[model samples]
Target: MNDLEHVKPAAAPKKPARRRFLLSGAGLAGALLVGWGVTPPRQRLMAQAPLPVQDGAVALNGWVAIAPDNTVSVVVPRAEMGQGVSTALPMLVAEELDVPLASVRILQAPIDKIYANVAVMRENLPFHPDDTGNTRAVTQWALAKVARELGINLTGGSSSVKDLWLPMREAGATARGLLIAAASSTWQVPPGQVRTQDGHLFHDASGRKASYGSFAAAAAQATPVEVPLKAPHAFRLIGHAAPRRDSRIKVDGSARFGIDARPEGMVYAALRMSPTIGGTIAGVSPVPVLAMPGVLSVIDFSGALEGQTGAQAGVAVVAHTFWQARQAAAALSIRWDEGPHAALSTATLFEQMAAALDGDDEHVYHSRGDIAAAHEGAKVIRAEYRAPLLAHAAMEPVNCTAQVSGGKVRLWLSTQVPTIAVDIAAKVAGVAVADVELHEHLIGGGFGRRLEVDMVAQAVAIALQCQGRPVQVIWSREDDIMHDVYRPAALARLEGTLDGTGTIRSWSSRGASGALGHQFVRRNLGLPAAGPDKTTVEGGYDMQYAIAHQRIAHSAIDSAVPLGNWRSVGHSQNAFFKESFVDELAHAAGKDPVALRRDMLAGHPRQLAVLDAAVRRAGSAPPGRAHGVALHQSYGSIVAQVAEVSVEGGEIRVHRVVCAIDCGIAVNPNLVAQQMESSVIFGLSAALAGEITVTGGKIDQGNFGDYPVLRMPQAPRVETVISLSSEPPEGVGEPGVPPVAPAVANAVFKLTGQRLRSLPLRLS
Candidate 1:
């Protein structure tokens, strides 16, 4: 084998340049002081809690630091998994601190409750997007309070920009304000005479100027006080398109992911898990494979031993090389236990979900005016839509490098939740959470897959068996996909009515699927499954359309197949059902899809604006082209999309798409546009080629050969229009996803005259 390590750099640099600010120099007294004791969410949501701050650098609050190089560093708690949080968040600090984007540095912070992501958890509560009552306001506030106390640091649900929008700016402004106060005393000038620009403070009247680094010591000692923030009109960096900080390194192949980590004396490890979702290894005879090339050792792990953590059970093959380890893993003889789900099939899953809709145990997500009374005398419209389960299909398969010795463990990986990763690694290493070090690396892609730390636990477990030798455990692409916690396949039944004059009278929708909120709570929290997951019903009943008698609900069906968040989670499927159904209602009433949405969204100016802009931006499809439109809200943002589709010879082609979104302030407009285009391709992949089918308790397809992704040729031409708003920024990553599928499905019906309800829209 080639010497893969000969040309490589040294093993993971141990704590390269971490520093703690002393109170003597910064003279700051807990400037951004906040605290939270790690209280895992109970049957609600999951987040990594805080660990004690390592004693290296002088600690200011939890974020923001300065070095002698005139670079202002911001400690970002959220993970950057292809999203722009790493850049957008620092912009908030740089913007407030009056520094150039180039002069800023970002530090991926160690886990602490002070940095817990409260927005995603607050969003978990059952509050509709259009809900305006005190119940929603109070409930969100109360949940945020609890999340803060618990210090749950999570980064999913596209809430990174939203959560840190104000706090980061405040941190910058406070630090900057302290500097001004320090300068006020030094130059014998009132604060009004001092100003900051490009990381330098100047007193023009006194003709005195000093770089921020020159006075950082004194500024740290100054008292922290509240200061005014930049108005929307004055933002120079917040709205502007700054180059992504990680783009250069990523493009140059210099960025290190979990797969690149090579600790000193580290060996490669390979795993072969039971093909069945809940299957396990009853026993394994390792003697037969012990003589294989580079074979080190084999360790057994019960697949379900780490419940709620999603750790896969089986045996690990440790070897001198990954290829050697993989080769030996293929020869291991094992006794398999297929578990209770062995008999499960996709057909039976659908049947059971259908039966669940007919059963009495149903969870009502949203109910307003009486549906029975409105349907009694109106023209009823009915249809059913189905979406198949989906896998994350991330570019880099899940992998983790771990080392354990002397009752302490350290993990290096690309994970979305480091705090949770620490906890799970500790649990698997038979140590307390505090005895673990998580060195997070750049993610190849997350899309919610990294939210689960089972792989980390599995790697640490393998490292434990290696006697202090660092082990990097890698999952083959096949193993990653087959054992993935997939997005649930859902079935929705819709019934709506219109008045004699074609005005809407009532709307009722019922869906049968495994509720994500309940499953997350039940699986991650180790508590009783609680009420319905708002995530499941987010795009289902959260529309702001005007319907006097409207009822939207779901029948929670538990499928043996594992389920978790996809790009848009429930909205991914619900949007297709809701938007397509809305188009059907439009056809029944003989109204244009665009016009129907505009009228329904009259009371919601924000929703109406995006809907109108999308339709207008799309304008007339060129000759021989047809258009379809959809509008939906999720994660505190509203989005509208118009898909231009052309069908020929029974094959449907999406030529282009026009999208409009109102996510409050556009922290970075270019990033918003990039995400919109990204989501379009992702959604189209699911609409055209994506599906995860389980038969006899095993995934029928493995890898991209059968589970195809959208390629460059098949990707549609995408154009996006950003709605100008000064309100706090809302979700950007996932909102673009929900509208694309429905838009394409709606357009397909317009061109083919066939209402394709199931996904991968096939026409005969």
Candidate 2:
């Protein structure tokens, strides 16, 4: 028996011929009670039971709810944040269900148990050498079970669609099977005698048929079946381009983003806080803003200093409107305690990290062969590279709305992690997780910033203190910039030994960076240290190339500056460091950059395929339009980028970029291409202009004026070559991000004959 055989049908069966006729008459009576039954109070107080699927519909995880109308409601757990996942992920389900693409509707997923991505559990691996056998298998099993029961969905690590590819399709196919079974039983025929197309079920021999809506009630009572999914060759919509589901809405300003959510009886809140991150309000003087027009209340929020994980303390100005709140907040004055981060600065932090790299203390993440012997016998080349702090400058500033009433909480936010937001809100409201209901909204942009639900916590705290009134907390552009959990600065030193045959004999890399795992370790696992910072050592250590002798070590430098994952996590910085250094080595060996990478990666076909494709697309260009190549495999996809750039008047201008990616089976070729384009633009901005600097523990940049993003006029022409393969779709969002930076920098090097070692490439 297949997996579906295990699912028993509902105990109550429909009364065959008379059920539909009776239901039609009963619908008039039930219509009056529908609003009452589905009210917030009723839905919230309802016993926590398995979600009941309507007849002819199926629950594919909690996020996806398919209806008898042939409408597929894709519960998007991840914030759309302009990543196009809303369009791409639904295609995966629609392909297997064999439904018309136009019938699907995208829904922002609610906080539930079935929405969590299980791949993030990999972060729990032990980093120390002695802790090799760190209960990974057991932990994964436990997490999987918890995820199934709780539906704790996450939207980071570029694993959204790839993670749900199988389970989601299975859900759709299973639902289709049940519909066939139900129709067969109703017609007194074998299941094989019934056929389904679009939203209709037919019994050919009987010359009778009904729409799925008509049989929905009967289908809901039938036992589920494990139906086999169609092969890629059989897919009509999976790899094809359909207009993005959100395009019309977004274009016409009909997309209901987080900023667009306006709840009834909602009061807007603007925060006034210390410039220094982690600082707290020592005292608040409300006299300055008490008389301000539209100012309702001045609440002192001391919760930021309560040692809560990822908390921010501030004074909230509640007002009638967002503009009023902002005015009140601007007029209010408060004394601040700058906390332990008072002395922190961007320069000093980088110095501290650089100092750690020179020390003997280090963790060897991965190593092989004899590095010492290879380094001693061959011609060695070394280079040091650096990337400064960065921020996720999402188009929509951080905002969340919370309504706390009678020990129950409801929140609306643009968040990547709804489960975490619900938990935080529950903790803040002194309620259970089940008591907190989250309505996720479309993110203006996530990039990784929405992964933390701090804004949700702030909204909940304010709402809870307002005597059950709904509060909408809005973060100004300054609040977003000054208080952002920045992408940490990193310093990498690469040493490569090349033999007479132009082959790299040994590769040794050491990096020093703020530990990303530290926050998780300190808060969740209660560990003192986060061990080796994988983000610091990952690129060179986990190099896909077939290097004979290699050793990659990391020196974890603790810093007060808040750090979190950026677009491509460590690979964004590491790709620049590793790929740029590889190009340097190629030039030193008097070999082509493409040829050098191909030679080093002879054993890896996937890596070679992408690299070769990028190179072929680039051609053998020289001088004015110099070609630069870089390859990186992260989040399961191997991507190679070839950048063509021209340096004029000491300014680097990128003309075009050729990207070759092998992300398994392209679920939607159009979506993959769109993601690649988005990633390149995002990466280009970070490579050429992105930086989050600090002075006296305060971020120096605010909004797009100072912290600029890539504009359409400046965007380079991007072409994507997707490797057609039968392998499962790996990742698309972040994998495209890592290669663009290094490719551009390497191109700049060829154009000017100056190695641009650092990010935000400056020409002097």
Candidate 3:
């Protein structure tokens, strides 16, 4: 008898005969929705059972713990995915704790409501990015209260630095104050006279000092006080080039990723999902792999419930080694119900979008004056811009290790959302949410793919049938690409007018595409999507130009294709659409691109500052090179870029890029530069080479070989200039992404005199 026969999968009642194995899966989801309403976020995080700790270590609070060996432990709730978050966030605690940054170590915290990411949800609301009026204020405050009560701890939208800035400082200061009080009672000195530095307290008059470790026990028992945080001028480590904390581990090969997880008695699994998007498992014949070498069993994976169906039914092959499992999976024969998506392709989707443009159901996101009247009186310029669907393609393909034993499940993953991961895994395993234990590891790369919990839930369903053995379900390079939650394909029809003096008098745009947020809310949260989803029109409407009359609206096209948050989300495509059209307006009026933008942005000092710095770095678009300039903001940060290009052998070759940004305060200049460089590479790849095509109701490209990323040799020389500021830090991870594509496209237009309105700019 097969080992899987003994395991009972989650319930998906009323599923087709082929998918009946996932019985009650929908019921569990319904239970989760019911639970979300009654459970407060604070109770979710603070009320969870604590993790087992070391013998001599002590839990100080939700975010920090101390060991007797003089090493201070900081409990980081955010996931680090090569964004330098591990180093940047910990700096906050160490700065306030008054300890050497090196003295602190990190422990990835467990699943709790406290870690739910409130900003991701808040930022996605249908409000203007710069909205600070009563409506925005009330909405934000209400969302914050709800998030706090529900414990929405998450790590996306480049919010780690801003979200934890004040709280981490307070936590550290509270700890420091308690330690000082403990020393005051013991040494009979005034608490005010006690000064701390390098993890030790000093009393000058008595000539006495004590290490933090010596007073750890007493400090834990003492009351905490909210001491004041340091002013910007008094900072030591912050704004300085502090070394990254995970450098040593990553360089020495000791760093662990999701794929590196190895629980004792661990088995391996390789899954083959339905080839068609949003399809389901119709039937499976496992005879081909049942007797293969090292093959333990051929089982069912209840399915991935991430986008349309949310739960994707599939078959899994488990064996002693991953390679063995993969090979066996190839040998098995399976049938699928491709559903309504059986005949879908990108070409067909574009036709639907074209039809939507002429339809009546347009969602007007922003409007000031009458666009029709503005266009009728002025010289009208019309152009159409399109962007193809994109994949996150993180360096590491998705993988998760899980085990369901004794009515409980443990998951080891590299996930951006731990709270959601816990819920999905438990829901799939048919176990209580509290019974799930999540062990988060350093992510190889996230981009935005890891934010989805579908892979984690799949691992749990696979492990549930392994007779108490741990199983690591891995998606090969092919599996990851073909089934990715893709960046929605977008089409925009832009109409603008330039006055006699070459000034942009009016601007209007109508975008038609699948709504990434619309699908997200309807599929993931199981909620009805009402009103405008801000993500669809964020980049197109939120620009800082000084046009007199402007209108931005999107004709919504409901789609079944899986859509997800790619690097910069909507800003990625919308920036390309908006900026390129602005370039077109400049040419129609016979004006210089940079000079034209400078005129429009004269009143916005921050936007103009970056635009000036970028132009200064690129140096006036000298003789041999064509320069294109673009400006956009995301996650509360402004970025401007100038791309220099030259045509060679009928190919557009970008030689260098000069970029500048004002993200409030640069927490760590080194990390900020790293992110800018990374974003340039990411955006360039999409502009020059990134394209995902669908045919025969399936993905045509499989891995890096067919879908090439930017190579090091092809990477342009990127210069990042960061401005100085005293305000709170804003996002840097995604701010740099929106400008690169348009900047390059604009330069291409200047070089060849052919205005390219589509992505993957190819010279015909």
Candidate 4:
């Protein structure tokens, strides 16, 4: 494979110089004093329990804190699941705050209402033009309903920084404005006369200066104003590559992941859940586990919250050590009610979905122009695609530490939804949500798996049963793999017609998938069924391609298997189906995939721009390499990926991948590049080697040994080309995922002359 490190830079001109700012010591002191003084003593006291003010710093949520010593602390709301949000998010806040990257310290934000993400709420609205419901009116109603139900918009749908981009920067800018206000007041000068730079506030003409620390207390009293954000040309720290704030801590093993947490008097708990989905505990005997070494107690826990299927439900063995708990839990004898899903099998699920696809029951997600006439007047090509159920396989598995005392419960866990964790823990522990204090620790990885609060509830239950002792509930790799909220298996049938001139005439896609709404309804509303799931219809309804005559419909089939969001949610599977079918249509029209896509996307300048750049960077036609290109829009970003592949000894070898992304304005180019690479690897792994097969309602794969992730040796060389634009920053975490699988699969088709429709593209 050719080394990408040696690739020459493209002919694009060098970027313009960015605006620069540095906070002086006086500015820092002024900001700190204002922050301290404005924050009431009562509020400070309320923030004290389980909320630690780091040495030399005053706390503000988990992300932003000002220290008496002139340092800034930034709390990261989302876990660093290797997607680079940890670094990118802080850059957005620090850029407008006028603090140097080095002066800012990143802290994991605690799970609370204040820190909940708002983007998920917006995405949940049924406002798309395709829906039959009064799209505008229903959207407004749904938005209000989502806000009322969720309490706080929580993270998911790759909307961490994108959701917070404007708000968080506005927060920083608001704080800066207040600091300047405070400094001006302290100096007895007009606010307009005071200029803030770095950590210091200065009256340049008067030569008077004060550190932000000195003004912080006073600034905290000033009501935040609606200041206009800085223009793109004024961005300094945002566009540039700053060293990752968590790099040093992660490299030094000082980062506290869920597994690293150990509270005082902590005991370990291990559970043996039923082998089937929706199973419940029927009977349990503690006598078998009590005599085991280090076993403290064995208790039956059947009080799980509704709608959390696949969670372990049975007796838990609590002990001094995790190993002891595991041993005792394994040795304990228990009886389970396998529930109604005992007869479930993967084959049965596929059959049920196929039946749904053939049935008259369907929801029209999108429709445009005259699809019937277009199809009747042209040559048509059709194909069906299938994607299997998948597990999140987060590196840390599922674990949480909880201590319940009296009416209060304290929790430490690596959770994407900390507020939800607290709520569920409070419910399980029989306390108010406010009484549950959650310490959001660094996650080993989340990937949408931690969004569920089952583990948190389990920990609370175990802790409550342990009297006042803290109990850490740990899920082994086996437990995590066997019992997880899986990504839904889907079947998509596509029909595309081309005119005699090779112009596309009609496009139609029919899909059957497990309901994502069911999980939401079960968790949020306590209802067993909402209407048909909207998530199952996302990518099809939101297709960015300019196909004039098109229809996308979905059949929401009930599955015995439990399903929830994976990394890219619905797009992970839908992108493969849509793009691969597009490639097939391109081939049928006797056109190059790139050229065909460009022709179809005549009005989508941003999408076409990324597609053209990625193809150029990949060397449109390389020697001994077949290239496949796919462009997709998800999470408000357009990404185009070109994969170069070669088949050797019946194994598909991916040599390199060139990715071009137009995520509007990149906060940190290096971080964007890194996340793209990470997303590519993650998506590629799922395409070539990921699947969770089941038999008799039990997962066939147990650990990494059976369900393998992509190893370093199999990883391809990744090259990312970013487009510079002045538009608002879109999502970076999941946009890269949608294009990878289709790109690679199309390349494999080019090499073999045979289309591989399924995931884990096996050689037959």
Candidate 5:
């Protein structure tokens, strides 16, 4: 059996509920504030409970376990969403433990405070990258503490490796130290005399050797001695292209995704959601559906759960099989209350945002020098850009299997936030959090979709009516597309001025969009996050270009579209708006686009190097193709891309994309390259044809035919160049996504002489 199929028969040690944890945190708030200056960050090296050791295996701290045969198991708390985290993260441990990578086994982690995603939360702070003042520092410190206390195990923001870099390595080193100490004691020698390599301890002087398994029991009793992490030069697994551990299993079809989950006496449920956003089921006609063959029951799924704003409450048809349930669901008639957003439409949303942009409700997120003074007597250029709401469109449709029996709940699903999932399950099932057990599966594709628990809540709600039997709730492709928490539609108005020396003296960008972070906190954490939202103006406000007078503002417009984080969050669209406008500035100044960007990036060497690398690697486009370049930084990584494009049969054909990234150090250079290629294709799909429109508060597109992704024939040849850097790993998953759209859009301008300011780049 695969390691993913293994689960401890005994119940894991209980952890505090999220609500109770928050209440306790509130109680300690006063003391924390008093000792704010001296309190250290929470230690992540140890778990709150012991590791779930298998038979004949010994626990070695919270992260690793050693078995009788010297097999090692490393617990990875983050979701493996085809990002190679399942491979890259274990390399961190294997490198420090001085073991061959193949000897380590991957295990899904249970709920633990030590696995909280503090790095991604810190990245969400509304401070500019250049802002290193006390306010930024203090806010980050407090936020990190809050994140640790909350302990929401999230897997997005490309933060899995970055967050676990130190903790995982330290865990390995700590285990290695304990084993060496145990071996040295047995040999009657000094601790330094026993060296560890390849899962074995050696006392070379005495010629005594033993496997780590031999010292496992002794190591558990030994007091842990602090061990130093391996320097980069000594690393054997990291910084190399280690094969993805999941590749073989996935290739051979043994990898289990959420949809593949099977439980004894399992039933299938087909959900028929409300047609409109925020709508609820008024009544379900069960006459014919109840009489249908294999049909179990028609369940009323009405009312939204807490923090599940904009999620549709509908009816579920339960049956013996998915096919039966789907047929019954389609045959049933359900009345819906369309709610207040019945008249909402995409055009109206744009109108509302445009009005907000012109109004006085905007907050200036970043301001440098005097924009008015710098614009005086300078050549002014102005433009507007728009990006439509987008769907995550992950390969696997949303699904979850829930078993509510004997006053306990068991959940099997693919989720990016297991902690949040457990909370939602407990609350919905009316059970103590400890009574809820979650079996997280490998996500076919997350791309930020599984980060929400609305689907989990919906599944559990349907399962409750199954009368103690397990029900696997599956969403049809149409259901998944219509009910998706979509990426926010955004619009930006930009202005720039060129001086007599052809230098950009002033830059001002005003963006309008639903505040994703604020909405996310409301929907995910059940808290209203007020004040400035960093995600609303990230790529625009945090540009690396060294403009003297720069002002970036954002107006948080209210909409019923139900905003959620997409692949790159705000940077996905903001980069296109900011970089396209920069290209406009370059064209107006009669300078090469790359050259103008290079001049402005004089102060940012890493960004400049990445930009130059893409340009140089691209060299020149093939005959009849033009090249366009863009640079963007997000999640502590800098990425630049050059798109080669041409117009054929009235369609924009991108023949190639040359990408360069400085994501600090690529833990797995092969994964880095794969991510770059994936990002380019994903972003290209959005730029070329991806859009989610709404009419009368209803989602317009339901399946891929209408909302198409980039097919293989349309996928551009992607050449990824990784910069050799000594900096700590940043993010490869999302940083590469922010640059591809702008690069392709700018390239289309060179090829067609038409500036496409909107997404799905249509020819006029």
Candidate 6:
């Protein structure tokens, strides 16, 4: 008898789903119900539960812990996906705690509301960047409180440093204060007289000294009082090039990704999902797979967990080894019900977008002076741009090791959203949320792919049929690429007018794409999006170009294409549309692209300075190489890039790039530079050769052979120049991505005089 026949998968609870719907739908109504006067402030610095202690380590608070052996550990909730959150965030604590950077270790934070990402949510709200009024403030405040209550622990949006800047600092200072109090009590000295440096407390008066470890036990008992953080000038570790903590592990091959999980007595499972999106398994023949050697059983996982938005109904083949499982799964014959999307294709979706654009369903995001009046008798330039669907293509394929037994489930995976993962696992295994044990590993690459928890749910459902043994379910490269929640195909129509003096007088942008935030909420939170998504019109409306008459509108077309967050979300593609159009206006007006952009930056000093820095550093392209410049701001960071391009035999080769960023303060300059280089490569790959086409409702690309990233030889030499500031640090991970595509497109135009409007820019 098959093990799956004996096991029963629990039905997902309806109450929590209803609660999620109500909470997500309430929006302002819920905020009003809990009046402002009665609303409690979100407590980010406090621990909702006890931090797990190990190896004689005593919990200091939610964010810091110390062992008896002089080892200090700072707990960070964000996932490490090569963006260096594990290293950069610890700098915040180590700076305040006065510990050597090497001496401090990192601990993965537990799933809790306190660890929920408030900054990412607040930044993602629909408010425009220039809207700094009371309405935006109150909405942000109320929503931040709601985010805490909702407690969605996520790591995307480049918000790790920005979110934990204060909390980690205060946790460090609070821990430092507790240590001082402990030393003062033990040595019979005044707390003010004791000073700390390099993890040691010293009193020159009595010639007494003690390591932080020596006072760990006593510090745990002492009441933690608020201590003032060190001024920026007095900072030691922060703003310095602290070597990455995970460098040795990653270089030496010790870092474990989700696919590296190997639990003892673990069975392997290979999944075969439906070929068409939203398709299901109609029937499967398990006898053929069961007769094969090492094949344990064939388990049907269709509708295992109902109401999961992006979940794929599939069949899993369990065997002793992954190769065996893979071969068995491939051998199994199953009839698939392709569903309504069987007739869908990329062309069909674009047609729908075109229809939507033609219709008057466009929702205006931002409006200023009359664009119609400004366009009267003005030099009008109109253009339409298209960006195709894109897959995340993370280095490690989506995999999860899960064990469901005794009304409890344990999961081993690398996920951006741990809380959602836990909830999904519990729901699939028919257990309480508290019964789920999650051990997070370092991600090979996230790029917003791990933000969804459908894989976790699928893994738990597969493990349920394993006779209590852990099952590691892995998706093939083909499955990962084909089944990805893609970056929605986008279309934008831009109309702009240049005045007699060649100044951009009016700008009108109309865009159409699947509502990524809506789909994201449905898949991750089990609810619909509350209001207007800032992501749809981010790059178009939130520009700092000083345009007087501007109107940005987005017509959200609901399509069958599964849409989720790409690296920079809407800015990833919108920058290409906006900046390319700006280039068009410049050329039409007979002005240099860089000089025309400079003309529009009178109000934004930081953006102007960044653009000037890039231009100065890039200089003129040498000989045949032409220069293209683009300026874009995302996630509170401003980035300007100058791409030097030379075309040979219709191939666009980017020789070098000069990038300038004003991300306020750089916590770790080295990490910031790494992200800039990484973003440039990622964005350029998509611009030069990234596309996910669909035919007969099936993804055309299987792996890197078809959907290729930029190889090392193709990568440009990136030079990152950081602007100096004392302001708080903004995001660098994604801000660098939005400018690279347009910069290259604009450069290609300068070189070949071909204004390529579509993505994967091809010259005729």
Q: Please identify which of the two predictions, 1 or 4, would achieve the higher TM-score against the true structure.
A: 1
Maximum-TM-score candidate: 6
Cα deviation of 465 in candidate 1 (Å)? 0.5
lDDT of 6 by residue, 1-764 (tens): 54345223333433333224223322633643365535675777768888887898888888899988889988889999999998999899999998988888888888777888888766655677878899888767776776777777889898989888888998999999999999888888888888999999999999999999989999999975457999999988889897888899999999999889888999998988999987876677677678899998787776675687467878888899999999999998878889889889999989999999999988888899999899888868899999999999999998899998898899999999888888878767778788889999999999999988878888888888888999998999999999999998999999999888888899999999998887888887776665676777788888878789999999998869898888999999999999999999999889988889888997878999999999999987899989999999999899999999999998999999999999988999999999999999999999999999999899999999999999999999999999998999999899999888889989998888899999988889
Q: After superposition, how far is residue 390 of candidate 5 from its true place, in Å?
A: 0.3
Ranking by lDDT, best first?
Answer: 6, 5, 3, 1, 4, 2
lDDT of model 6 at position 78: 92
Off by over 4 Å in 2: 1-70, 107-110, 122-151, 205-207, 520-529, 620-623
TM-score of each: 0.92, 0.89, 0.93, 0.89, 0.96, 0.97
- lDDT value for model 4: 0.76
C-alpha positional error of residue 627 in candidate 5 after TM-score superposition, expressed in Å: 0.4
Q: Rate the local accuracy (lDDT) of all candidates.
A: 0.79, 0.74, 0.80, 0.76, 0.85, 0.86
Which regions of candidate 6 deviate over 4 angstroms? 1-40
Rank by TM-score, descending? 6, 5, 3, 1, 4, 2
* Colliding pairs, model 6: none
Rate residue 562 of model 5 by lDDT. Answer: 81
lDDT of 3: 0.80
Give the number of the best model, judged by lDDT.
6
Model 4, runs deviating above 4 Å: 1-65, 107-112, 126-150, 222-227, 303-311, 524-529, 620-622
Weakest lDDT window of 10 consecutive positions for candidate 3: 17-26
